[model samples]
Target: MKTIKSNFNAQGLVRIDSDDLKLEIKFESSQIYLNVISVNPRNLKTFFNLSDLRKLVIDVADKLAFWKFDLTVTWEGDELAYLGQHANPNILQKFIVAKNVEIKNLKGFAKLLGGRST
Candidate 1:
């Protein structure tokens, strides 16, 4: 695995920056896998196939199964923020298994102790 020199500030936020963009990913626990993404609003179709994992896809699925859902995420904002709609307590535990990402509660820990996004 390749190692990236990254740091989490006192507030516990992981900031990632590259040539094209800058983004922040906050972990409630300590898992590297997340369920959110941002795509070109006008051409999401073009970016849709870029990856098989979509964090909102996972979070929404989780919300569908259970009325209330606890989650962990890492992705661009605004685009993925709408997922809050699924956070209702009435539908949180409906799905036991889902094909998409896994929902984890980070609770304030960090994952990927020394690795970069794959």
Candidate 2:
């Protein structure tokens, strides 16, 4: 894994590139935005397999465990294919689970967290 760039000031950002994936983590106010993209050449014609997708999510979740910020994951390209045509909430739930971290409904924290998109 390689960190392409990082800034931890207010409204910070971090970009990591590894294998065929890119993780862009941005901190804005009370929330954290995690954008995961597949950089594999083959992804142009195919979606990420379940194993790779799961690993990506778990890896990101683990890395962000130290932050108390609410997280919003934006799916793109082949990643969206894995999420299905409608962005299945159930599958998304599985991906966002981190060891010892509580995943809560965005509705409950929307006001306090500044209404970040889920």
Predicted structure with the largest TM-score when compared to the true one: 2
- Candidate 1 off by > 4 Å: 1-11, 28-56, 59-79, 82-86, 89-118
- Per-residue CA lDDT of candidate 2, range 1-118, in tens? 9655343435889998988668897878646766765455454225655457556656655555433334665545222211211223455565554352334444532322233455
lDDT of 1 by residue, 1-118 (tens): 9645433222245665554334555544322324333222334333444233344465565453343223344443212222232333223322532433343422211121111333
Q: After superposition, how far is residue 46 of candidate 2 from its true place, in Å?
A: 18
Q: TM-score of predicted model 1?
A: 0.28
- Clash pairs detected, candidate 2: none
**TM-scores of the models, in the order given:** 0.28, 0.36
Give the Cα-based TM-score of candidate 2 against the true structure. Answer: 0.36
**What's the true lDDT of residue 15 in model 1?**
62
Regions of model 2 farther than 4 Å from truth: 1-10, 39-68, 77-118
The lDDT of each candidate is 0.36, 0.49
Q: Which candidate achieves the best lDDT against the true structure?
A: 2
| Candidate 1 residue-wise lDDT at 77 | 27
Task: Give me the displacement of residue 33 in model 1, in angstroms.
Answer: 14
